[model samples]
Structures are given as C-alpha cells and as structure tokens.
Target chain A: METTTLIGQLPEVTAAGVAIKAILILAIISAIAGFGTYLERKVLAFMQRRLGPTHVGPYGLLQIAADGIKLFTKEDIVPQHANSLIFKVAPVITAATAFIALAGVPVFPDFTIPEFVPVLGGTFVPSIASDVNVGILFVIGMMAAGLYGPLLAGMAQANKWGIIGAARTAIQFLSYEVVTGLSLLAPIMLVGSLSLIDFNEAQSGGFTSWFIWQQPVAFVLFLIAGFAETNRTPFDLLEHEAEVISGYATEYSGMRWGMFFIGEYANMITISILAAVVFLGGYNDFGFIAGWIMILLKVAFFFFLMLWVRAAWPHVRPDQLMWLCWKVLMPIAVINVVVTGIVMMV
Target chain B: MENFLASLFTFQGFAFYLFSFLTIILFWITVMSNNVLYAMTSLASGMVLISGFFFILGADFLGVVQLIVYVGAVMALYSFAMMFFDATREIKEKNTNGAVVFVLGGLSALMLVLMFAAPIHSESIQALYPMHEGVGNAQDVGIVLFTKYLVPFEVAALMLLVAMIAGIILAGKKMDKSLTEMMDEDAGEDEILTQKDEK
Candidate 1:
C-alpha cells in the first residue's frame, strides 16, 4: 500500500487520546524502570546464588517502593566546587531524553477506549506516540543526545574521577553511535522506510520474514551497539565503581541520582524494544502466540540478556573498548551495509 | 473572548513562537555568558531549538539530523574539549577592535539581506525536483539529493574526507607514546635524577 494512505487508514488519534497515551507511557514506563531495578537485582542475585532485597516485602516485590522512598527522602548534595547549574540539569537531561526517545517507540499495540469511558470515550491511541514518519531516526537521535547527561554531569562535578568519567563517556558514546547507526542501516535498506510501524508491517509474514534471519550480522552488530549504547555490563566502563567511582554520577545523590538510574533503565527498555521491532518479527504473531505477547516476550528476553551478560562477562579496559568500537564493530557494520546493498542489487 | 483566544492560539503557531522564544534566549545566553561551559551549553540548546523549527515545519528528517549531528556529536565533542580547559573559570576577553567588529557585522547583515532577496528577485524559481505526493519527507529528500544534487553532495563528502584526514594528521603527531607510559617515564627519570644527586 502507498505510505500516505497507510497512515490515513489508521483511526484518527484525537488530541485527548494522544495526551492520555503520553501520560500512560510516562507513568507505566517510569514504574517499569523502577521495577526493572528490582528485577535486575533479583536476576543478578540469582546468578550469584544469593538472596536479593528480601527484607522489603514478600519475595522482595515492594523493594521497588522502598527504594523509591529512600531515593525520594535522601538529601540532595552538591559538591562545594561543582558547577551547580549544569550539575543540577545533567540528570534531568538524561531522564528527559530517555523518555522522549520512547515517544517514537511503540511499547504496545494501539487500542481505542471503550465508549463507557468518561473523558476519552472511543478515542483512538496510537501504539507509537506521535508516529512521526522518521521514527527510527528520531528515536536514535534522541538516544544520541542522551550522552549529554553523563558528559555534562561528569564535567560539572569538580572531581578528578568525574572528569575521567566524562572523558570516557565522550569517547565511548561518540564511537558507539557510529556503530549503532551503521548497524541499523542494513535493516533500513531492506525495509525501505524509516518508520518503525512499516518495519513491523513488512515482517508481518511469519518467523521466516524476520530481519534477524536475513540480516543476522546486522542483528548481532545492533545488539552489541545497543549494549554499549545502554552502558550495560562489559561496556559499563562509564560508571565502573572499581575505576572512576560511579563515573559521572560520583557526586550525585538522592532524587538526582535516582533520575540517572531511571534514565539508564529506560534506555535499556528502549534498546530492547528497538531490537525486537527492527530485527525480530516485531509485534507480529508466531503461529501459536499473539503479536503483543510475542513482542513482550522478545523485549523481556533482550532485557534478561543484558543482565545475564552483566553476570557472565568481564568489563573491558578503556583502550580495549575503543578498539572494539572503531576497529571491529564499526568495520563489520560498514561491510554488512555494503554487502546488503549488493545483495539487494542482485 | 473564546473565539479570539482560539484564533490566536493555533498549535503550530504556539509551538513556533515558543521554540523561537527559547532559541532567542539560548542564543543570547550563548553570546553573553561569561563561563565557557555555560556558553557552550546554551549554544548547544540553541542548536536543538533551531531543529525544533524544522520539526514544526514538518521536516522530520532534517530535524533529527540536526539533533544527531549537531547536538549529539559536535556539541558533545566541544564539551569533551571543554573538560581539558578550566571550564569553571570565567572567560575574559577585551573588545578592543571596534572597527573590525563593525565591518564584520555589517558584512554579515549585507549577506543576510542578499540571501533573503535572492529568492524574491528570481523570475521563475522552481523546485528542481518537486516533492512526490505519496512519498515520506525523508524519501523525497533522498530522491532529490541523489538525483538532482548528487555531484554537489559527493563533492561535499570529498571535502569533508580531506578535512578529516588533515585533522588526523595534525592531531596524531605524538600518537606513538601513550599518555600513561609517558607519565610513568617522567616519574622514573625524576627518581633516577634524585638518586644520582644523593650519590
């Protein structure tokens, strides 16, 4: 179908619906990000053969709430020599960009409110909020912008460790960004559209149609880039306590620190969703499973994989990280794109 | 009153005005701020708001590129460099050459006037590649860029490549020795010099 009409055929998303959807995303995702901390701890603990957060509530479920309370109630501290303004704004940038990137990501399938609903009865909410034509690029761009959070934070805080962290953030983020963009380019070439919805629709066919099967190299490259982009284990050199003392977050405390935590978890979720949608069959159904469930499972698996890798692998040195990005991942991604283009031509 | 408010506050118009207001304030800060870090931050934000104008104009692709290229890469690199300098200190510069400043300002104004006037003065200005109806904004831009402006695009890429290589050549002169190893060598020499003096 024509691209224009494809959008036109979708039910009109009223302003109220959009607003409601935005709020839903913000509330639910923030909650999920909080819950993710709990889940990560549990998963990591399980891997280490230990109990994690058992005192908070039954099976440590309400540990999220307890942690939230602690973060909220903790005193906000600013170091004496720190640049106060930028230091304060740094975590906000991180959290805001992570959430903003979600605006282009479709977390769940679109649905309309029932007529019985009071304010937004029969209102249609899109899966992807806004649904801009350049969804993939916009999402990637916002995530790229998120590097400022750690970069500014480390710079603002007047600590030698923080400065070192900031320098690492600059090099790591800048280098990985090229890998991320190049890795995604091959899948984008096959899809012929930048919109995530189009990517989903293109793979509506079954498991065989998944881009992961066709562009396995791109999928692996994207996953590696995603791990680095999200600052997960092995690449978590940005805040490795053993090296730079929490890196950019060395001086942050209380809610400001919590914001950074939330931002990191949100980014993890966003990268997981991107992986599921772009490479895996997205929200497309497998024979026995529903589409929504399939996507949720895919996202959960990727999220779990991040934690598993954290448990399994050792962090690379700063020089090694740079080498992997520039010398290895970047070259492979470029070659993958070239090969994909050639195959398409043939 | 309701009709007047409704007429005055279109979503697009409101967004444009808001972004414009923020952009102007940010640029003002970029120019007037004493601290280098503050000036850099404001400049980066101003660039982002400029991209907001592109989004408001329905150029989604351009807005995103502006964000990724300028705010993401360029400004981050600037901040990285700022880390080396004492960014906490206020920057002080003398404004002694008023005549040179005035001449440069006048030249820029004249250039801006010419830029605005050129479009109006042309008799039959037409889009070399008219936008296709069913295509998205990105695809339309890609089509025009590849087909109509291919030569200029390739030339620009080549120019950038030359500049990049030149930059590497200039920066990579001392690439053989690692910074840590050099520092260690200096420490070792200091220790040896102290031992020789004692002997």
Candidate 2:
C-alpha cells in the first residue's frame, strides 16, 4: 500500500512511451555521436588553421553521412589467427555498454507526446529510460564494463600491438574508475542520492547552488578521469597511433572499427552529460535562460571542452597516466570526499 | 496469443526463469570451456547475470555493486593477468586423481547440504535492516551497514589494506631500478662472468 502510494505520486509514464523514448534516445544519440566526429574534425582543423572536410558539404556538414557510407561499404576483415568469436563480439560489447550507460542518464527533460500523434499520443515520456535508484553507480558500472571491448579486441587480434593496447586499456580504465567513483562521491554525498534526477533537483536553486562551486576539486578530478575513461587525448594510450599503430584497432576495419569509434564518441557524450548534470545545475533553469536550453549549453560546453583539450594537449605516457591517476587524482578525490563528509556532519 | 505475450512481458517469474537459465548456462560454459579466455569471460558474464537476480529482488545497490566490483574491476584484473599467457591456446587438464576428486566432491556436497539446511533451520532469522517504506535502496544499505555492520565492514577494509600492502611488497622488489637498467645490469654481470671464465 505504501509502495503503491509512493509510486503513484510520480509522473505516469506508459510502457509504450518509454519504448518510444528509448528508441528516440538511441537514434538521436548515435546520430549525435557520428556528428560529433565531424564536429571534432572541424574544430581541430580550425584550431590548426586548416579546412576540415569542406569538400563533402557546406562547412562539411554531410561528412558524417559520407563516413557512414564508407564504413558500410568497406570490407570487414578478420585475421586468420584471430580468436574469431571474441574478435567479432568485442566491438559490439563496446557499443552496447556505451548505449546501456546512457539508459540511466537523463538526456532531456520529460515531455508528453501530442494527442494528435497516432499510437503513442498523449503518452508521457521520461528523460531517463530506467530511473534505477542507484543511477550514478549504474552508469559508472556500465561504462567500466566497457573496458572489455578494447581489452578483448586487443587480445583477440593476436597482434603484439593489440596485446599492448589491451594491457594499457586494462590499467588505464581500472585506475581511472577508482578516481571517477571517488570524485563523484563528494557530489553524491552533497545530494545524498544516487539518482541523477535527485542531483538535478538539489541544484534547482540556481547557478550559485551548482555542485561545481561546492566540490570544484571533485569536478576537476571527474573531468580528468572522464577524459581518460572516454579514451580522449592525453590519456588515449589505448590506441595511441604513433606508438601502437592503431592499438587494439590495428586489425579491425569497416564497421567493426567504426563501432569502436561510435562507442568512444558515445562514451564522450555520456561523460559530457554526466559532468553537465552532476557539476553544472543539470536541467534547471538559469535566471534568464530556460532549463532545457541551459542543460543543452552545459552539455555542449563539456563536449566542446573535450575537443578543445584534444587540440591543445598532448598524449601522456602510460607511466605518467597511471601516476597521475593513482598519485594525483585519487588522493585529491579521497580528500574531497572526506572533507565533504565532515562538512555534512558538522 | 495476446494473453501469452502480455504474461511473458509482465511476469516477474518469466524474467527470473530466463535470468536463472542464462546464468546456469554461462557458469556451465565457464567450467567446461577449454580455453582460459572463454572460461574467464563466461565466468565474468555469469557473475553479471547473478546481479540480475539482485535487481529482481529489488536490491538495486547490491546489483550495481556486483556489476562494478565483480564484472568490472575483479574480472578486468583477471583478464589483465590473462594477457601474459597465450589466451587462444587450449588449456589441458593433465592430472585427475580419483581419490582427491572424491574428497573435494564430498566436501563440496557437504557444504551445499549445510547451505540448504541453514536457511531451513534458521526460520527465526530477521533482517538487520528491514526494508523501510519510502527509503531508497542505497540509503537503507548505508544505514544498516554503518549502524549494525560497521565493525565487520571496518575489519574487512583493514584486511584488504593488509593484503594490498603485502601485494605491493611482493611485487615491488626491484622498484628502484628501471626495466632497461636492470636488463643492462644483468647483461654486464653475464659479460663479467664470461670474462672471468675465459681468464
């Protein structure tokens, strides 16, 4: 009776509406992830004072479509000595885990479909696909599980470079995961709930109430860890081209390689959204700006920050990467968590 | 057909059965696979599916913990160890002593019997932290753990710390020397030994 009442107070979302929302999120996020590649190229080119992909469309807007066509048409190659099953499954794991992480993330605010819209008309669609109570932990866990993609891919290919890449993937992901969880602990404590919705609500007071102001150390640690987790520049030793060819992706081609790229870009979006929601005021309205627009700007800022960092920064050596994670980031995160706990108690 | 579809989609029993079936199959694969990589992968996946059982039971925190600790960190560490070996090569079990197998089998059987018997005998067992209405899963878990189970938790943490220190001590024998420096030193020693023998 109590449980029913509690659940009753929440917004009424239909199963069909959730399915529609999930499909929309999957479709839109994937398109955005693809488009992100084009954006990165354009941004990087602009940074380097060169035109990027301008021949394809106006300002290279159609390059994503061209890349998609190229990826589909290219022959998928599997090496003879490769572990055939795992080799085939690796990229899928990467892509699947990435999208699964997004399920817990609230990409947009809730909205009800118009009554005029046929089958799913008048249905309320939630921002989050499944609002598990342990939302933050769930997202982190799913992303951490994505380590298998590169790890297995590297090992399955039977290449020395691939093995090295896989080894790097294991260490890089494992170490950063500690920092990621610890850094987020401060915000989780402040909000006193793991749900992203709750985190958003806690910060609804306005921009000044954002967790970033309170736990700036955590925010920075999380951002650094996010970059590492997404295999972005500086921490992208997993597939560092200069050192390890294409790393784990050396033997992969066509859509298989493209899947890894998709997973990476998708992870980038997930991290960006996480930072936006957790550190920034999430989907809360600013003084002059709307809630949804504020969130979009925040997510875009984070996404662009990732690209900017890539252009500005150079790759860290594997040793330096580990050192930074364990020595610098982890310690700072733990300290921040402890301080937050003490302050809360006081 | 419509009723069947509705029941299949809505029934918790169906999900439970499906998850259990998959978990059993994955564990069986873990035990029976010849390749170490396949075995390890199956074990990891089976562990993940077991977390589904936790989720089904409404232990959301436990389920996510299982995912992070077992599927993510622990299994990733195992796979990292696996990379040192030729993972694609088939593993062969050479020795199968009948008497030792019988002893281990008997021990396992006794343990399983105890496991089943304990739950049946302990009918009076109560939850330390009974599920509170309107409380989130993580909060309930945290309250119970920090209140009732604090001592055990701290002990476990201390145990982990000890083990971690031991691991570092064991692994950090040549911490002062770089890999190249150590290799060069060994090479020089070898040359010195060879020169002494020649003289």
Best by TM-score: 1
Indicate the DockQ of the complex predicted as candidate 2: 0.56
- lDDT for model 1, please: 0.87
For model 1 chain A, the run of ten residues with the poorest summed lDDT: A1-10
**What is candidate 2's lDDT per residue for B1-199, written digit by digit as tens?**
7855765686676788788789989888987888767777778778888889999989999999999888665556565556556876787767688999899989988997898688776878887668999999888988888998999999999999999999999998987778877788799789989999999
Residue A183 CA displacement from its true place in model 2, Å: 0.6
- The alpha-carbon deviation from the true structure for residue A50 of candidate 2, after best TM-score superposition, in angstroms, is 1.0
**Candidate 2 Cα lDDT to native:** 0.86
Evaluate all candidate structures by whole-model CA lDDT and list the values in order: 0.87, 0.86
TM-score of B chain for each model? Answer: 0.77, 0.77
| TM-score of decoy 1 | 0.92
Error of 2 at A58 (Å): 2.0
